[model samples]
Target: MMNFRKAATAAGLVLGIVTGLVGPAAADVPAAIKERGKVLIAIDVSHPPYGMLDSQARETGSDVETAKLLAEDMGVALEIVPVSGANRVPSLLSRKVDMVIASFSITEERKKVIDYSRPYGVIPVVISAPQDMGIAAPADLAGQALAVARGTTADIELSRIVKESGVNARIVRYEDEATTNTAVATGQQKILAAALSTANEVSEQNPGLNLEVKLDMAAYPMAVGLRKGDDELKAWVDEWVGQNLENGKLNAIYEKYFHQPLPDVIPES
Candidate 1:
């Protein structure tokens, strides 16, 4: 479903432009961002509870609210650039976005290119289906088809597990989270590999469908992704996260969407 060759080619196409865009200001980005008077942030609005569009097409979610707060703190305008999970890094690298505050989970592979603020949230990744499916273990997924959003860490990890374990399941990758969720909710697909919050959104939106989490893949720490070498910007963002987290502002945002308070201490990646 995912064309790895195409992805590689796309990355190559952007490499030259991204390299040119990474100037000295990329290292001292806080001053540059202030001078610009607006901070560009990339977010995946297709992912619900974290980032999504409301009924009126306004961006409203935990991540969106958090970005607003960050902008207010910086005394800058907030510009949200819509992005798919696959292009977040490319957007940041090309200077299309100052940072990414979507459910940008920190991972070893991603860290090789971008710096990340200490984690602000933990999101659970899971494989979900109706209660009747009873997916109790990895073996239960064998020969089954699971809908997944393309290029998400959940998709990458799920693919790894399936391949390494020699499971015969099929991974149906969609262009975005909304499509993946729609496929499962509409009965076009029987199972979903996505965040716990995403699966919950699908079930909530389509009340008649009783989608339920059947397997807990893992809980990932989400952070703000910054350009590599932007130590000053990263430090400022880390401090901002700590202040909001300690004062309960971040937890308040989390509770608004998650319906529960954040943990006393958000685990670091």
Candidate 2:
């Protein structure tokens, strides 16, 4: 698991207010990026329905499709740069990628490090446990062990829940979702796995490992990320997303992965 203490401290852990939708414009962005002939997009090649490597090793998912559409709207080529949960921000900061279309949550803390475009989806963070656990709520987590993805908002939300609720559940972090899911499924740790999206994917695959709980601990609004100070790029992506939503393209992407309509655009409150 990635170190949250250091990352949170470096980014400052403050509750964030939702932001209103901003119209996209082409006037303020860099000419190079606007006309570079290609948009370098960072995507997670391991997380399915968000960004993942298919059997053919091709990047496929809602995030990738949406990004490709955005690139087309800009009249640019789409270059998918594979990334992971921990490296999404670093990839953009280091210029390894121009923008991250991964399942990135837009938070006030993250805003300190990178700019987030309009929200694409709001995923409720929940717990996935084995069939015999009988765990069903945050309180049930007391004195239990839980598994979380290394650098996810699930980690942040779980930490906050434990601290605020005065629960004694030990949070055991893992390198990736596959590892966490495997551990939980096999009863290696008897730990509950936390997730933001694709709870059905985890449950469907692990029929033996039942999702015993559905705590709406937090609703994480996922968005695209850009390097700080890229207001022009932010606006462009934001506008593109809005147009897709209106055209029903965005909802199609959401249903393809989630088997449901996308959550409404939630402004920070």
Predicted structure with the largest TM-score when compared to the true one? 1
Over 4 Å off, model 2: 1-29
Backbone clashes, candidate 1: 0
lDDT by residue (1-269, candidate 2, tens digit) is: 43423432232222111233332333234577766778899987677778777789788888888888777677778899887777788899999888998878877778888888867676677766655766666788877887887787777788888898898889998876667767766767665545546555777776766655556667777788888887767766766666566556777888988788865444441
For model 2, the local distance difference test gives 0.71
What Cα-based lDDT does every candidate model obtain?
0.82, 0.71
Which pairs, if any, clash in model 1? none
How do the residues 56-164 of candidate 1 rate in per-residue lDDT, one tens digit apiece?
A: 9999999899999988877789999999888888999998998999899888889998899978888888988887887898888989999999878789779987988
Please give the TM-score that candidate 1 achieves against the real structure.
Answer: 0.87
Compare the candidates by lDDT and give the number of the best one. Answer: 1
lDDT of 1 at 210: 79
Clashing pairs in 2: 18-268, 18-269, 19-268
